[model samples]
Target: MTASVILAPLVPVVVLWVLAGLAVAFVALALWRGLAGWWLRGLTACALLAALANPSLQEEERAPLSDIVLLVVDESSSQRLGDRAAQTAEAVAAIEAKVAGMENTELRVVRFGDGPEDAGSLAMTALAEALSEEPRARVAGAILISDGQVHDMGLVPALPAPLHLLMTGREADWDRRLVVKNAPAFAILGEEVTLTLRIEDQGAAPGAEEADLTITVDGGAPQTYRVPVGQDLDLPVVLPHGGMNVLQFATPAVEGELTERNNAAVVQMNGVRDRLRVLLVSGEPHAGERVWRNLLKSDASVDLVHFTILRPPEKQDGIPVTELSLIAFPTRELFVEKIEEFDLIIFDRYRMRGILPMSYLENVANYVSNGGTVLVAAGPEFGAVDSLWRSPLAEVLPVEPTARVIERAFVPELTDLGRRHPVTEGLEALAPEGGWGRWFRQVEVSPRAGQVVMQGADGRPLLVLDRVGEGRVAVLASDHAWLWGRGFEGGGPQLELLRRLAHWMLKEPELEEEALTATARGQALTITRRTVAEGPPGDVTVTGPDGAEVVLPMPEAGPGKFETVWQAPVVGLYRLEQGDLVRVVAVGPSAPREFEATIATGEVMAEAVAATNGGVLRVEEGAPDIRLVREGRPAAGRGWIGITPRGAYVTEDVSVAPVLPAWAWLLLAAALAVAAWLLEGRRGGRRVSGTA
Candidate 1:
């Protein structure tokens, strides 16, 4: 309990001062006039003033509160490198013990890891939140144990006490990282695209002047090149095919490097064709000839070359050849000279004609065998004596004509295999309830090789796709496809089906018959396996950046797609393999923010620490001793960090009592006035006796 004097004046403070001034004036006047009772008058004035001025004594019950010390521990990915994790653990324990021994102080610990969505270390954010939970008045100081690679510096709070840092990491630590300065999202296929890259050595990399750079595309074989470190490199690359291409660039990690996580980087660039060159050869005027022509003409990217054989060499009409108004077809130039330049070659109702020699036809077959594409749209001629099946091109054709044509109306339908094939996977869903439009005729054919994706007229092969040595071949055994385009009976997916078929032939990655793909959001990895093979495609084996492998079972999500979502343990590159297929995906980044700079320093937190009058010390040197200091004084020194003692307490009960009551004061003043009167009478009586 504590007691102190507090004023409880009967009148206002200003009124009490006025009354005291008047009493002093009256005493002075009586003394100056030579009054007999002057001394008594002075005593009476003092008593009256004291009675009017009231005072009280205040007492309180108090309880002292303990000072709070905040400890923020960094558990982010960067701290896990080398011996930093061990260092952080040791520092935390030492701090806890030191605070436990300090008098009237408590410790509050806050531990944090990698921030959400690869935001890196958020030590400042964690510190601010922990400070808000406790009383600012009770907080003595805050200490952070980290590598000091803070990513959220903007969140530093206005600390009420000093802030100290126990930095983790060695001075000799160094790292080699691959940096991609510029990479385009899309590049033209078969054209050289320039990519800017740099190889950097951070921290104490001694005598590192040169390094070997390894580059790989789509998980293929790697190529090595000797490049200068600390310099920008312009690499020229040509994509082998059209679609999404994954390019991986890496440099060898040195012996003393902090981590190999940033030694490699991955870039995904989409390959697109500048222009699609197509050669369309029509045997004669046919109903479906316009369908292929119109479709190819509508696309701005397609370069269409069309020719029609209106008159065969054997046609003996009685007219001069000059007046025939017919220009000789450049078969040699198109078939022999520039065949490879064309992306796709289409034959509309075409048959083996004497115009193109057997040698030229052989060249066409050779073209398909050597990385070229051929699409056959057959008519009744396919079943005739001059059918292409009877020529040199028959080797690449997916179907063999049976010399028969069915002239009955039937709707085209997807075969069991077609339902799983990427080209025709969802075509059936676009059809009406009554199915697709009817085709009046279809040539009878048997699948000699390759997949029978579509069928009609008693399950006869209608559409078949095959892959030659390094090329692709597709056969559509009818000339009535235009019927669907014309809305003959509610047009089917004429546009979508043909588009998918064309893109598939062009080697679009999304339309591959068998493929493995992955996409990442945050640390969750979505793996998708697309195939037409029977049964489950089996579980996928995932390999992380740390070379740790995990086998995850992929459940069937669709007709031919197997998928699963697995949470990645950390950020970095991940390789997925199921059978012979391989796919690589970066979970958060090829180089996570934490590993971007592994050699830790306290420079990032220096300004904030200085503002709070705190010290920054290295954990390798030894944990500093914790001490208590007065507020507003320096709280850190060479070998010790300090917290301020805030003399904080809570008042339980307050009591206020007047020193003297108002009525008692009034009675005492009246008594003093009567005594003064009696003294003055006695002195006057004595003076009267002397005068007598």
Candidate 2:
């Protein structure tokens, strides 16, 4: 119970002053007229003023609110490593018990897990939010239970009390992590890309022996190399083909210590072409020569070198020598010497014109067999007696000309297999009103053992793809494709179709017949397996960096395309496999922010807590018991902790009663004046008589 004096004005203070002025005037009049009452009038005015002030005693009942203690727990991925989980659980239980026994104190526990959007533990952010919801008067102190690895320190709120930390880790904790500091997202196929990498040792000696590193591409045989410790190294790697190249780099594990799951890193580089060098050889100068030149010249990446036999040896024109404007064609310089310099060779309506000898034709076949691409855009001459099939290059071509020309208006259609091929799939948008276009002419050709991708009029082979030794070959049996560009029967995707076909023949990885791909977006792994033949669903085994294996079942995403998604439990290199196919992808950082440096240091949280007059306490010795300490006194003792007690009070009612009535005050003033006048008059008479 509490008591205090409060004043409620019964009458306005100005009115009380007016009443006192009237009383003073009456006393002065009585004294001047030989009536004595000055002292009595002053006494009456004092009593009247006191009564109008309306003084009353106020009482209140209040109980002090308990001091609040905030407990912040770190539940990030790093806390789950090794014995740290058990240690955190035990510490949390002990903290709850200690907080329960304290008098005039309450505990508020806030648990923080891995942050959304890949931010690490948001302990400081959580603490700041909790502080904003509660009153500062009731909060006495704050305690944090973490591994001392906080990501959002700038979010620390303004605290009115002391804060402390109970770190969770051993003094001898050490870790080593593989770091790929800089890596390119895309690299040209067959070209070396320099990758900057570093191997860092945390809480370990720098002079330790260098570690052995192994690098593997697409899960092939790993190439072992030795890398020195605590230094950045530039590694030159050549991309195999166009598409996603999964490269895994790992360091040898150590003995009798922390886990080695984070000792490796995986990088994915999308392969591209630095330049497309094409050699277009034409037998004679015709209208199709400009078409081939325009198509190849449209792409900025394509380096086109076109040659045409403007004058055949048999064409005898009776004219002076060197009189014609045409220059001599250099067949030997192109096909015999610098043939390897070009990535692809295109025969556009070329025949046995005798300009390229039989030896030069054999050299072109050898070029295709030695990892070079070739495309034969056949014309009516393909069925002539001098067809290319009669030359040494016939072995590399996928189809054989049947000496028959099919000239009819028919629409080009995708085969059942072509509907699933990346080159022809999803190409309906290229046609007008989403309908296939019609071709004016197509050669009659019989497909060999290779795959038939497109069928034309009368169900003849329109396009064929086959492998020749280590290279790829393709045949487009129509020279009227340019007619589509001229909007014949509603133009189609002439450029896109031609581009995809040319790129596929160059052995781009994304267009491979059999492929295994994995893409990571945040914590989800989207795995795609593409193949031509239908078989059992491939086994997708994702091996996390911690050596944990999770086998996923892949369902069909599309025709001949199988897909599955796995929510990754931790960040690291995830190995995917299906039969002989294998791929590696990085889910998150190989070393998580928490485990990046396992040593428990209070460096990050120290400044934040210090702003609130807090200190860091190592839990190795034991946590102190929390207690309420008075203000301006020591907050902690030898074995116990102290918290400041906060006293709070709220009003129940505010109504106040008047101390006196207005009529009573007026009557009392009159009575006191009359009595004082009579008494003073008698005293004056007695004094006069005594003096006489």
Model 2 lDDT, residue 646, Cα: 69
**Candidate 2 structure quality by residue, lDDT tens digits, 378-448:** 98999898989999999888888889998888888888788777778767656787475688788999988
For residues 512-532, write the lDDT of model 1, one tens digit per residue. Answer: 999999988888899999999
What is the number of residue pairs that collide in model 2? 4
State the C-alpha lDDT per candidate: 0.89, 0.79
Off by over 4 Å in 1: 1-62, 281-301, 304-336, 351-362, 384-392, 486-488, 520-527, 535-555, 563-588, 627-634, 654-692
Best by TM-score: 2
